[model samples]
Target: MPSIMIADRDPNERTGIGWLVSSCAIPYEKVLSAGTMAEVFQLMESQTPDVICLELDMVGKGQWDRLKLLVDQYRPTVLVTTAEATFERAMQGIELNARDLWVKPQTPEYIRRVLTRCCQDQSYRMQMSQETTGVTGRAGEVSYLDLFFPRPLHGRTYPIMLAQLEDPKHHPELLRFFEDYPFRDKPVLLPLGDVIVGVFPDDTHEPQTLFHQTGKRLLMDWEAMSDAPLFLVMYDSKEREQSLNEKYLDAIQALHIRFFKGYRQLTIVERQVNWTMIDPFLTPSEQRLWVDMLHGGDPEVLKQWMYRHFSYKEEPYPEPGLLRIRLTSILAQVRRYMKSHGLDNGDLEQEYHRVFETILYSPILYRIVAEMLLFIQRLMDLVQNQREEVRVDVIEQAIRYMERRFTDSGLRLEDVARHVDRSPAYFSTLLTQKQGTSFRQLLTSLRVKEAQRLLLETSLSVGEIAERSGFVNANYFSKIFKEKTGTTPRLLRNQKKR
Candidate 1:
């Protein structure tokens, strides 16, 4: 099927060229147009037509490299069309292997003749190329791996597919697939029994056709092999350059979505992922409750949380990318949770990586969820377990503040709360809850203890001791002292002397 794309900034010129191409004798399978270079690169991912009618005038000063890159990779029959042209630019186009240079507003007859000729020439060139390269048999087929992989060619995007078999027993046969894909389209393969990454020329290939043909080949050779359910994620790195490892990470992230859905023959980019994806299992209220529970230590609530995340469901599959996004969000929460609890994040990050890889390859969603939830639960457990220690520290600090400030008659619960930055009511509640005593009782105990210390350690008179211990006078101090210790200050001093 013949195809053509018109690249032009002017809509009128694009319309004119499209009308001419339509009226041309060759019936194009795809007649496309791009107003910018980005759109041109985007369109090339799925469809690299036999002919690309390029508008030279629209190419920005910095875009010459991008133009040269297109020529280097796809080698479409480039018809350099511009309203204004130059000898230097025309020669440049010729050097880059552009088929011809033509002025814009081309007549129907001229477009018809030139386009037909270009498509014919391209077909002839491909036939010669395949023969010259000796790619006739299955055994001798060339993979982009032979030319690319360790060293990637510049100015070309590679479409990568990561395929993981749900069953690992089929791994041995799948490993053989790593060396060479069982297809006419030689996909550069990286083999992991549970994970396989396949790469194809981004410019000249579409993911669906490539994966389909590969799947077909595998079926024909294996001879009633197990259902061999494959979970796959396909994408092209056309927008930006990325390393093979980075591409693999993208696939793994994509694989995270596999936890929500059953096996798919092919899973291309069909769904979007966002925060709402985890709503079915964990909602906003649940998130807040979990945060609260981390402090409160609700074991039953924690059990319910694990149940929802790890529970199995046959119907109502979640969206494919949601699981990965949710997992990522959970990991972030873990870090924040650790930070809030005054814990280091380094160990958690390393632990998360270990668990994350396992999560991706786990056979059941229950295991993956269990692994992640365990990590989250471990962090939450740290917070929960520290609840007592934290409470003790707060109560102890409040007691010290009371002892230091008791002599100041103006001292009040609000003053103590202000020092510790807690509301008076909250500080008071915490004191009773943690110490089994109220603020007034604790304050009085501190004053009596200080009065005893004065009687034993120094010869301070009862009146002076009363003033220092925050009581108004010796009488009031003695009265409170008897109530607390069953003795008067004068009697305590006399006993200490004895």
Candidate 2:
């Protein structure tokens, strides 16, 4: 029987996650929850759990150091639960032996799938550890001597199947599964650490069922267990060529094909000569849909919109060169959108090559698409610099409009905004930010300045000054002028004579 432990600082998360994991009924001997590192240590001393659902946020203090110590000491299958999970964090969580990391807001179903995989892995490792001594492979290579019996003395050309690992971490489980594969009686699978190879001369006595046996056996029940796709290249020695070495060469060519075209169904090197590339797929109908979004100037929303276009249904399987070309076509849409915002296409080819090269370097199809989408996002983010230039011009125009019309007593904020071709609310905010005051306050200050100038520089009476300065009446002018300069308008004119 296996055991499970849940460790987290948050009580709600500890209990909630524990309850959900237990609901899966993963055949555990014990299920314990820990709120602190002290409790985690205590439970670990009593019985080191077979599986640990660890919350990285609860690790606290030393963070990665503490987590490393726990992982090294216990050697438990650790499933990390983090509030924030990025690609880098997930990469850090991948240990050579046992660790699965997931982010929060995950459904019970996803948790169950990960937990099931962990338990199955842990159980397989424990069983294999005792049964096979030299079978534990090194990181880089595998020893063929410890793996299989010395090559059959009746050396004849045998069929070979080659598959590149989706994740090299799954090598041990895959190798172990191949050891007792219920498919063929005499087939021997050689685990090369990074690659899995199968030799079939076992059923050659049945000659007709020779090549079809391995492919047909794998198609049943294997796909459901491993959602991760592998680059599978299977070759037939009896059907195609006379030499086993030639068939092995064909397997190698097929693997290289996967590196370029991206992984899909069984690839036959013998059958796939003269395969044509996909036609240029620049769908003009969908051009406006993506262009308007880039001009709208939110890279994050544009990225999400791009993500919706991705699906596994890439029919008439595309070549690596064709896929790269498709990526460039999508990027050209962004460039077209940028041109409207004053981006020059002068060094566009150099810029396009840099991003296109980066997209091609992605190992998987979805990853290639994701990298291109992120590039488009960064491209759209550059539009903010242009937007900044436009904003300054609009604010300057609004300020000048206010200065020329301040003496008009019936001046309204709406009319000023309309003069500058902006909404009243937007113009008001820009004016307040730029001039440091509201429309009404600036208008009053301008009128008072004119009243003060007439008192000092002209022989104008208080009532006459008020009429010319855009005040409603002489009494209102006196009240406002006295409030502004702390003296009546008539008194200021008399004082100036002294």
Best by TM-score: 2
Give the clash count for model 1: 1
lDDT digits (tens) for residues 7-67 of candidate 2: 8778887777677667877766678888887787667645678788877666555555545
Taking all chains together, each candidate's TM-score versus the true structure is 0.42, 0.44
Q: Supply every candidate's count of residue pairs whose N, Cα or C atoms clash at under 3 angstroms.
A: 1, 0
Worst 10 residues of 2 by lDDT: 133-142
Name the 10 consecutive residues with the lowest summed lDDT in model 1.
269-278
Off by over 4 Å in 1: 1-322, 329-344, 496-498
Off by over 4 Å in 2: 1-253, 256-280, 298-301, 311-319, 345-351, 359-363, 404-441, 449-476, 479-498
Q: Per-residue alpha-carbon lDDT of model 1 for 1-498, expressed as tens digits?
A: 667888888888779877766666465777898999888765653476668887777777787776665455455778887776678778767866878888755676777788888767767766655554322335333353433344443445556667777776876666675444323334566565467666654444444544444444353344344567666677555544554445555656666556655564445542223223444244677567667765565556666866776564543456544564565555555566677877756887688777877655555566666677677677767776687687788888878888779997678899888887889899899988888988888888888898899988999889999999899888888899999999888888889778
What's the lDDT for candidate 2?
0.65
